[model samples]
Target chain A: MTTTAPARPAAGRSRRPSGRRAARWPAWRAFLLLTLPMVAGLFVFKYVAIGWGFLLSFNDARGTIALGDWNGLDNYRRLLGDPAFTRSLVTILLFTLFIVPVTFALSLGLAVLVNRLRRGRALFRTTFFIPAAVSYVVGALVWKMSLFSGTPSGVANSLAYLLGHDDAIGWVAAVDPPLYWIVLVTVRLWLQTGFYMILFLAGIQQIPAQLYEAARVDGAESEGRLFRHITWPMLRNTSVAVVLLLIINAFQAFDEFYNILASNLSGLGRADGRTPLIYLFQTALGEQNYGAGSAGAFVVTMLIVVFTLLQGRFAGFGRTAEEEG
Target chain B: MRRRHLGSYVAVIVFAVPFLLPFYLLIRNALMSKRELGSLDWHWWPETISFQGFADAFGNDAVPLAHALWNSALIATISAPLSTLLASMAGYALARIPVAASKPVFFFIIATMMVPGAATFIPTFVVVGSLGGVNTLWGLIVPGLFSAFAVLLFRGFYLRFPRELEDAGRVDGLGHLGLYGRLALPNSGALFASLGILSFIEHWNAFLWPLVIGQDPEFWTVQVALSTNLNQQAVNLPALFAGALVAILPLVALFLIAQRWIVRGVLLTGIKG
Candidate 1:
């Protein structure tokens, strides 16, 4: 909390000749001391490991990271040829398409509403944002075991009963109706929408109050027109960044899918619901087919980059904040 | 004017209900007794508010919450601060310190931002495995030591950092290292705490890595422990819910204490990225 500057020491230290030597400690040496560990660790953990994964993908090595036997395009070919992997890739694509827009709209809408509040902005923000603190595992457990549980005693079923639907619907297990998506989508919406809402709130706050006054003077009679001409256009960068992060997040969707659909009471039967990360998890870890798994890694990473680049191009992501204002 | 406020309040209520319902159910079910869990009638208040679920969970040996809590604390508390300190130093060096390789080094660190950890997680695990890091605390700690994101945040902060402070440090005959140790690090208390606390929560909540690597029960984090509870035979439904609530207790407390700072931190991560 303290923002004060460091106190000036007495003149005795500077007056000594030895103190001059300490001050003259080379910038190069300081650079080495500061960055060496971070750089080296990054090199080893991220770059080297990712590089090794690329290399490992080419090899016929099964159940081991040791090298020598090279399989070339076989791993890539295998993953692409397999319906499961392709389905995972497709699932993530559809998920991104489904989730990004819905979440984007929801968060922006929530931000606009919450920002409208004069009395309880913090209260509402905290109520929404509190879910963001919950882990997916815990969230999934609550969603599956309590709220969306198939039994008649569950929350959803109780609501349905009150609405005249006598039979309890198995929300997660019904593949024909694809009710699992509701469970998956709602839990994700609950957990993530709040964080993005906060971001949109920040972006909304940066729009000067005078802009609204100016628009009112210009005879902008309705909220819709004000939002369109002022708020929506002003939130371009924040929206782009939010979409980019959401796309990345959606692609990396394993935790909820696993806990909700895969782990607890059931095995993963629906290939359509399995995300790329879940597919990769099974390929590498479950089946111990690390090569195909490694191959899938590059594929997923490329999708994230391509989707982000495409969205960035559309949204004009590189504009300066001052230019946006 | 009154209508507008009321309309927004109603809209807020509409959003808040869906958001708040799960938490309410989680708490209610956690306190419900085992027999009550199976009751056909919906009990808004459990007939007998029972601690049986909690007792079953804590008293169960298969999924050990106590050990997992210790492991999670050790991993988060240690790695988060270490990562924050390193990020600050690297950030300071990039922004403030004059070095020939600053631009290239900064670019190199920035390049890694595009690659999500979820992508190369297995590969990273394989590397950690090769280095004998599997199932050990070192495995969890080492891979996450240097955060490029945190470093980027620090570099931004330091770029906008007032030059007079560094100049004053120089006037005091402080070396570059001394200036960093004394002036730069000390001045960044909020940044350190904000980033560190966020990272701490992430580490604590981390499931995938811990689940994959922690094959041995002794190495379980609370998440893995909770997941492990699912597959265990004769599932204690009430106990499972209780365990879920317990797992979130520390996080809930941390969040309540530092919610304002957390939002600011989230705002930074959102807009900056």
Candidate 2:
């Protein structure tokens, strides 16, 4: 393969003086150089800092920014006993349960319908995907100001009135009784469903058409046969990946909640909505409690790790080398 | 058969309303003058449309949006191609090299996807601040510029590419660099474009990190400025909508330009491992 092989010396011998190993040296050096910045950034920003944050949760308020003296599990004890933390956990869980299925089903439905379209599929795809291109900040603003506005001038309330509801609802400000979470759920679905629909569409296209043709010819009904034999089984793997991702993403839901509902309680969701990440943010940046934020972060990191492991166990995420083979 | 098609159209229209209504309202409101905007009956179109809102948008002091646009464009241009190249190199190694640590490295990179950005916020802020990147474009670009997820996508595609091509390049006296740049690169344009657009959209719409890091109003991205402007006491819905429309226009344009790849990226679980 080498054009310059053995002119003065063999290529490997020429590359190394007295030959300890030339190829390995350059490859490792090049690889290290390419990865240095990312590794350093992740090490400092991601893992080590987070480990420090974890350590802070056990300590009392120390020198303003630095770690304080250790209180030995008192923070964990407090978090366990706090009813607000419990409510936050329950609220987020309920939000996930409602959001995941509705979104998955709607997105899957869109994918199947659009995929079935022999004409103008591109138009439908473009129309459906515009929301994804919309900024989360903008989308959340629209939801807050117009769509779910509690006044008659608000779009959602107008529509509700047309639909026979007597009252204009303060959808975003419904925190004390907890309807604000529903607004949070609706805003997320608006922003994300298009993105996931594209995923489901991808999964559907990979499915062979012959199975459906055979089913039709063999006299199976359209809806029943498609649901029972074809669509259900074919989309299994994609469904798992999507569901696990949604669950993790739901816990990470912040921007929409922050942008839209942040003001509803005077920015207290940084305290209340308190998805572990939000809690971490409030503690770290909002309250300037970097140590506790880091502590809260590590706890969330542990939760993310456990969930990912469970997802890998069940969904076979990131297929193993054996599976690849 | 006609009935079935009709039913399909009905279903699509009905289903698509929830998706389209918000955008429709945004556009409609953006066109209305502030006086007309208060009307309770919001429909698909306004009887009288004006650019007063857009004019007002131009008049506001919510961070020189033109400069932010330029910053976003420059960052997207630099970061997308650079990240693609970086991801491609690492992906090539992961895909082609049989080093003992290759799989382990891949897994480790993928595992960081689970690391919530919030956890890294303060530390990254401190690091960026120490590097004198705070209030600079570099602050925004540094953290997000290289994505592990993009590497996974590139690796997935590269692994599927026939190795014979690389072997042929090697046989022709090409170094690993030449083989990567010349042989592997041209063929992977769609994947690269897809990843580039995805990364650009993310950076373009990046809010929290940029909000924290870009403390200088001079460096604020459009998304950050829009959020700040809209949060003011006298919330001007019309001008706000206009700004929102302007802010999202680039993304919509990019998506349209790369519609095919965007669809491909989406349908292929272009995101997942």
Candidate 3:
């Protein structure tokens, strides 16, 4: 594979005596030229800032983001002592526990159905996947204002009226039994299920057709049996990846929750449906308590890291492809 | 077989209605006048197609809807291509170059993918502020001009690229630069388009960071502007709907046009190691 000896001796001994240096220059130049900016940006914006945030979490940096007044462990103590912050953490955990499984099941089921179709698969796929492109802000607003608005003419209210419940329910503002979860869960499902469905479809397609044919020939004629024996096992990697993504996404549930619940004149939705990110956002930006905000951010990050490591331990997420084989 | 097909159609239709209804309502309400929107009667189809809501949204005094839209377009336009270019270059290096340090560099970049945005949210704000990027469009654009996901995607594409073409080019006396410029980049049209579309949509639809950084209405993106309407005292429902519709129109159009590439991009990210 090395044509280096002939070309180097014939062309480079007189013009450029250091042939190896010349060959290396282009790669080094290109690598630095292409990667320098990204590497620098990540260093300053991500790594340095992350370190700064960790330090600031221990300081009493309020009304500004600078670091001067050192108040050791006060922010952490304050945040943990606050019931609101603790409640937000519990809210996110419950939300994650509920949303991840439902999203997983729904997306996988949709993918299986779509993949099995012999006709109009593309149409069904497109129709389902289009919402994934819609921004969370837009989807949340559409759901909040039109579909679940507390007005007689709103879609949910209209349906309620037709079904003999004559009152227009304030679906979002309701906190007793927490009807807002229905709104949050449904909007997320509509926006994201398509994305994971596409993932599952890709996974399903990668399964060898011969395996299914062999199963059928072996008298495993039922679709359920074939799926259990072949399709389920084949999609293990995709399923693990999907669950990992879902857990991460569920923890970082800010956009929809903020747009739907916090956008009222009364106050931020601190009482109900508040996730950790929302709590951190209000703490950091809304009130400018940068220390507590940074502390909350790290707490949430640690939670995510723990979950990811646990999932990886169970699912073999870090294993090399050769090892998996 | 016929019965099974019928059952599939029924299940699909039942599942699709929820996904389709919001879009239908968005378009329906956007086309309706304020009076029609407020009326008790639900007009499934608007009897009169009035552009009043759109006009109000464009003519919004409190929040500059048009300026926000322009800012959103500018930021997304500049950041998407720049980010994709940088990611592709780095990706090419990691894929083709035999440098011993390339392996560690690639791993370092991938490791950044796991850091949640929340962890970096505050410090980034402080850094951007200190650099005088607060309330500036560049504040939003600069921090987002490089993506680890894009780097991974481009690396995946380039790794699978057949080296025989590059070998042929070398035989024809084409140097590495010439080969990358004339051969490799030209064959990566789909990869570029997919990454570009993804970056564009992401920057365009971005909410939290912009909301935090852009305090001035002059620098507000479309998402921030739309959110302001939600929090205002006198909420104009029709105009809000129109704003939501306008905010999502370009993305929906892009997805429809480049449907295949977008789906392929999603699949690639999920399936790859």
Best by lDDT: 1
TM-scores of chain A across the candidates, in order, are 0.89, 0.83, 0.89
Tens-digit lDDT string for candidate 1 (B1-273): 899999999999998998988878878888999899988878897887999999998988878878887898899889889999999999998877654577778878878998987887978987898999888988877887878999999988987788798889989998878989999999998888888888888898888888777878899988888877765656688899898888888888888899877887888778888
Off by over 4 Å in 1: A1-25, A263-269, A317-324
Residue B120 miss distance in model 2 (angstroms):
4.0
Would you list the rank order by lDDT, best first?
1, 3, 2
How close is every model to the real structure, measured as TM-score? 0.94, 0.87, 0.93
User: lDDT per residue, candidate 1, A241-310, as tens digits?
Assistant: 8998998899898888888776422344367678888888887777788888888999888888888888
Supply the TM-score for candidate 2: 0.87
Given the true complex, what DockQ would model 1 score? 0.51
lDDT score for residue A55 of model 3: 89
Q: What is the lDDT for B68 in model 3?
A: 93
Model 2 chain A is weakest, by summed lDDT over 10 consecutive residues, at A1-10
Per-residue lDDT for A58 in model 1?
A: 95
Tens-place lDDT per residue, model 3, A1-325, is 1243234223423443454766767766766766777777777777777788898898998897788899999999999999888998898899999899999999999999999789899999999999988988989888898899888888998999899998779988888778889999989999999999999998888787888999999999988999888888888888888999899889998888988887332455755678888888778877889889888888888899999889878987454332253
| Count of backbone collisions in candidate 1 | 0
Which sections of candidate 2 miss by over 4 Å?
A1-20, A55-74, A78-83, A175-178, A263-274, A311-325, B40-44, B62-64, B97-108, B129-132, B268-271
For candidate 2, write residues A73-187 as lDDT tens digits: 7766666576655565665667778898988888888887887676778788777877888878988888888888767778777878889987878987766787667677787
